[model samples]
Target: MAKKLEYKDLLAAGVHFGHLKRKWNPKMAPYIFMEKNGIHLIDINKTLVALDEAAKAMKGVVRSNKKVLFVATKKQAREIVEQVAKRTGMPYVTERWLGGMLTNFSTIRKSIKKLNSLEKLMKSESYENLTKRERLMMERKKEKMEKVLGGILEMNRLPGALFIVDIHREHIALAEAKRLGIPVFAMVDTDSDPTSVDYPIPANDDAYKSIELIVNYIGDVIEEAQQERKQEKEAQKLQAEENKKRAMDEGADLENAPESHDEEE
Candidate 1:
């Protein structure tokens, strides 16, 4: 099981920002630091509440077998999001979001199917059946096909929910989710508005460590729910097998029962 994130851990992550040691120009500091208006940071209470809500919502989605999409536009957040997806077994968008990935899922799925077919054909050594030039042409075609469908293949299906590292850059994805009535969870820095998201966990989105901490926390919740479901399934299967054995044993006992001795008289 993954450990719960603590306030101290978050504060420790903030230390990574100390690299901004160079004298801050009034113009640059505003962009570098998480701030809005005169405020430099988000309220701790709000962040805590948001984190709790997001974690609970993630657990619910995992238990219900809903798909969750992790999105990140920044390099640092992208790395963290990728790690989170691996940990939680969820789909993610580390590269740019494809415009109609969710709305036009059927088309994307078809493309993915075609890519799979091509892959199988290439692996079948059927190339030997073709002339040298023909084989080279086929190989080039395969490479182009893979590049086109690479991102689509990463996604298994439309996401039930979305977790975005940056709300602004990933607005298209967020908007699609809203139109489809899918829930969204995101890390809203001080400058970003949290109202758009269903569950907004405010934190230092610019800090690599801070982003990782939040992503890992949510991933842990998802993993825990998955484990719980797996255990429940195992228990149910065990109970079913035991019941079958008990029924069989009772039937055998009945068949072996001694007949009434009254006939001996």
Candidate 2:
């Protein structure tokens, strides 16, 4: 069994540290423990509870076979989140968060389709026959699109949930998710409003250790759920095959059995 998150673990990761008291948002008072040296200390107990809640919710989302889009554009969180997202096989946005990423998904799909076609063209013989200048233009266009759309290249539909690093910095992403009625899970600091997200894990979003600890835990939960979903599909397939084989055997038995004749006086 995997190890559960402990209060000491969170403490070591600096998850209990929050922003300056003056910069704190009043809406996050419930999760604030107290002020020390002008910095608000997040309630470790509350943080643990919130983390558990968010993990459970995300597990359900992944188990349902729906994607969870990970968004972390901050310097401290981008690489950590990208690695976790890739390991979990989920779509992620470590680059700029386009305004209509979730709200106006149709346009994004068009861009993705174009990127696909461009890639195909580049691989075809016709691409080489083009002039040097034309080739350079196509390459630059492809590069620009890839930088923004690479993480979501395989995402063909809206995600079931969005996991964000900082709600304050990624407000646009949060807004787009809310506009589309998508659930959001995020690490909300003292400077941000926790109520803005569906599942808020209060922690020091700026710390590399803090972000890594929480994000890795969530990734593990998703991986476990994915494994369970795969097992369920395999089990269902096996049961179906067994039922079909049984029916076939029963039919064969009936066909080989001698037919009963009515007795005559």
The candidate that wins on TM-score is 2
Report the lDDT tens digits of candidate 2 across residue range 1-265.
2357999999999999999989999999999999999999999999889988987898899989899999999999989999999999999999899889988899999999999999999999999999999999999999999989999999989999999999999999999998888999999999999988999999999999999999999988899889888999999999999999999999999999999999998
Best by lDDT: 2
Error of 1 at 90 (Å): 2.0
Query: Per-prediction count of colliding residue pairs?
Result: 0, 0
Give the clash count for model 2: 0
Off by over 4 Å in 2: 256-265
**lDDT (C-alpha, whole model) for all candidates:** 0.73, 0.94
Question: In terms of TM-score, how similar is model 1 to the real structure?
Answer: 0.77
TM-score of 2: 0.94
